[model samples]
Target: MMIKWFMLLFTGFAGGLAVGCGFVAFLSVLGIIPRLMQLTKTIKWIRLYEWAVILGAVSGGWFSLSPVYLHASHYWFIPIGLLYGIFVGMLAAALTEVLNVFPILAKRIGIDDKIVMLMMAIVLGKICGSLFHWLYFAGL
Candidate 1:
């Protein structure tokens, strides 16, 4: 029984580490952090950015597996939500830029001349969707 429990725990730890490494590798391959740093002109804070990513990943995993809750007021959610939106927006931008997705999509859709408009539409749609979600689902 003891050996079985030890093996199970070890396996779980190994699996989690593997997944975490893969996630980090994926972000690195996507050049998300570097792109963000370049755009923000914070190349000197590279270590800080790296540490933030590592800590965020670990904290996210821990929070997901643990039954921890924050007792913050609804007002605090505004900044939190904004930060989440910024991170998601940056990640999406990085991925699209890295893969040249926008150009390819524009060419394929015969909207090469209106690529800027297409991008603006996507941005506006995302903003509207977020607003709707916050207003309807979150009641905020």
Candidate 2:
């Protein structure tokens, strides 16, 4: 039980960090922020975004696995949960971009780009998290 919780926590955190950083990097590549600012100053509010992503992933994973976890071996559900989390994150980012509903901080930073890259990162993160969960279940 404790191990499962720890795995979930770590998976969520790592997934969040990876996706958040990847998205920021993608924006930078598109010249969203000035080069000087991108290289020199640490982005403000990035930590907040990371935490948000982590929490969102964890919650999504937990909720998705609730039924399976309760009835069967909780371990088997980990991978599926993680995969579901990745899909949720990706979908959420894509929908937000489509609707132009990103947090105000994103606009404040002037991160103008294709917007599709952000969506891709989110989806990829969720996939990675799910894969990780699968690996854990396989004891790899």
Candidate 3:
């Protein structure tokens, strides 16, 4: 139980940081930011965002899997993780279509950035994954 709270807070913070950094870098690269900045010449922010993304995903993966670690046999977590991956993918795809905000924002910004979609997908996946794990344990 203590470990669960720790993982929750850790992943939440890590994911939030990544999402925030990604949002800023995304806006800059997507041409949404005002032309005055011209920040693309220096891709240091992009590097920071990329590393944040990798860090967040890894940390959140550990955080997200804490439940399975607690309840499952040593080998069960492996298959469960694979199943969760599939579920996250499907949830992400459906969410992107339903939200519609990304496309409109991108259209307004005047550039089609695929990375924008990728970032949104990651966030949606994490949220949906948390719910899925909750439901799984609740049902058992």
Largest TM-score belongs to which candidate? Answer: 1
TM-score of each: 0.88, 0.30, 0.29
Q: How far is candidate 3 from the true structure (C-alpha RMSD, Å)?
A: 15.9
Which digits, one per residue and each the tens of the lDDT, describe model 1 over residues 45-71? 989998998799889988998999899
Worst 10 residues of 2 by lDDT: 31-40
What does candidate 3's lDDT look like per residue over 30-75, in tens digits?
4432321232344546666557556766777678768654665857
lDDT of 2 by residue, 43-121 (tens): 6756764586568756766787586545677676768766767555544554454445654435666665545565566
Residue pairs in candidate 1 whose N, alpha carbon or C atoms collide under 3 angstroms: none
84, model 2: CA deviation in Å?
A: 5.1
Clashes counted in candidate 1 amount to 0
lDDT of each: 0.89, 0.62, 0.62
Clashing residue pair totals per candidate (backbone < 3 A): 0, 3, 0
List ranges where model 1 is wrong by over 4 Å.
Answer: none
lDDT, residue 102, candidate 1: 94
